[model samples]
Target: MSGNDILVTDGLSKRFGDFSAVSDVSLRIQRGTIHALIGPNGAGKTTCFNMLTKFIAPSSGRITFNDRDITAMRPADVARLGLVRSFQISAVFPHLTALENVRIALQRKRGDSFDFWRSKSALEPLNLRALELLDSVGLTSFAYSKAGEISYGRKRALEFATTLAVEPEMMLLDEPMAGMGHEDIDRIAELIRHVSANRTILMVEHNLQVVANLSHRITVLTRGRVLAEGDYRTVSENDEVREAYMGAGHA
Candidate 1:
């Protein structure tokens, strides 16, 4: 792998019993770039994510991050190495205030996450950082509101803020635009652009327009393997991608 690569996978494969979910997939994501993974439903995109994030062990393959082998690392260990994944489903704590959720994530990053006896004020630095992250994601106005009280789109933004508090070097975002209205989608896209300026982002998205607008490169998967990889225009115009999308009625 080259020095500029932040995430690399070689011959990555995953299986469940007799079923192969992802097969012989090799990917390289450059540092400080936004890369999109696009595929039809049941095409193993989420399975690939599970393998990458260590949520599930890959049946076979090698994964390297920053030139270090990480194929067998635990999820938490991978996270501590500045690799973080935001789930497709919302993950914010509904009962907690947005600021509190971000503060909790900040505390986790500071290694004091389990120190329950410490007063909230004792971690004033974490609170400050959390506020800064919330501001960055445009959630400062709703900082004190319960996460559940925020609009669905704003809740997603809060989740992004929480992820930012972890200070990840590479971020894995699963459908950040899922369930969003046009205005919310525009706002989130801008936030993603701002975040991608400093950190590498690998996103799994179904919205081709958003993918085209945000990604520096696009990787298209079909049935368990890469069918095409290139810029939006290149992939969209590729025969294999066109066929895959047409077969799935999503072209």
Candidate 2:
């Protein structure tokens, strides 16, 4: 860990039987910036993400977040330290309204018991914060709607709101624009930019245009190893990157 990096990985590796999913991957994510990890399909992008979120343990390496070694930390422990991963659509409770969902996240952040259901006054204090979170993600219109009833884009915005409820110092977003239309993508991009003003964000996204536009720094991965790391123009113009993308049929 250095003065510049909020997150650092040293010689991270993951293996499954004869297959090596990630090999000697190291990354430095600067404080209060949007950093993106991108690669063609089968480039071990997802595996690397899993490791960082502590969803899967790395076979060998160290992961330091905010100057603490989290290589052996559990996912819940990692989250408690203010490093949180955005949940998938399925992770949200279908029966709960968007406000209720964000309220639940706020409750968890306060380390309160799930017994908020018992006392109306107990959760009243969280309502204001939850509404603020919903507004931040542009989901204020859907605040009272069921999370499952919203459009795909709206559901994602609600999820971002719920993630924000946790007040993470750094957030890990997985493909925030994966299934959005152009308008939805644009909206979500702006939401991300707004929230990132005070915190660091690292995301794994396939949307090259989104990454190019939003990321302050980018790390390109190929064959389970880092192929390049720099600004979009520098990485995009690299001959090796062009060849790799072309070979992968993604150019």
Candidate 3:
């Protein structure tokens, strides 16, 4: 792999008995870039994502992160290695205040188990950093609000905050724009851009507009295989990509 690549997959594949969900999908996600994996429904985007994050084991192939072979690593172990998945594996506690939720994630990063029995003062030291994280995601004003009570957009932002607490080298976002309105989509898109300044992000998103606006590169999948990959313009102009999306009724 090139030095610029933070994550690489070689011939990644997954199968369910006689069915192949993903086949020979190879990717090279460069450091500090926002890369999107997009395809029509049932295109194996989710299966590929699950394997990358170690949510499910890949039936074959190898995954490398920062030069380490992580194909067989467990999810938590992968996360601890600074490759974390957000959204689909959200760590936010809905009933907890946004501040508390981020604080818990911070505690986890520090290798400290949740100390619910401890007094509030014991955890107060994490408050400053937690509040900073909330501010980063534009949730400082809602820091005291219960996570479940916040607007859906803000909830996703809070998820970003919690994920940030891990100080991940890479983040795999599963449909960050899913279920979001225009305003929320814009907010999260900008937030994703801001957060990508120093870390690598690989996202699977259905919003083509978001993919075009935010991604530095895109991989198009169809029928469990890569149809094309390049910058938005290049991939968008590919004849095969156009036919694939149109045939799948995505456009």
Candidates sorted by lDDT, best first? 3, 1, 2
Better of 1 and 2 by lDDT: 1
For residues 1-251, write the lDDT of model 2, one tens digit per residue: 47889999999999998899999999999999999998888888889998999999999999999899999999999999999987533357779999999998898855758574586677888989999998888788888899989888878878888888888999998888887788988988988898897999999876567888899898888889999999999988887887885455545
Model 1 over residues 197-220: C-alpha lDDT tens digits?
Answer: 789999998767778888999998
- Per-residue C-alpha lDDT of model 3 across residues 1-251, encoded as one tens digit per residue: 69889999999999999999999999999999999999988899999999999999999999999999999999989999999898554446889999999987788755757667877787788999999999999898999999889888888899999989989999999999888888888898999998887999999977566789899999999889999999999988888887877455643
- For model 3, how many clashes? 0
TM-score of 3: 0.94
Off by over 4 Å in 1: 246-251
Ordered from best to worst TM-score, the candidate numbers read 1, 3, 2
RMSD per prediction, one decimal? 1.6, 1.9, 1.9
Q: Can you tell me which runs of candidate 3 are displaced by over 4 Å? A: 89-91, 114-120, 247-251
Q: Supply candidate 3's per-residue lDDT for 111.
A: 75
- TM-scores for the candidates: 0.95, 0.94, 0.94
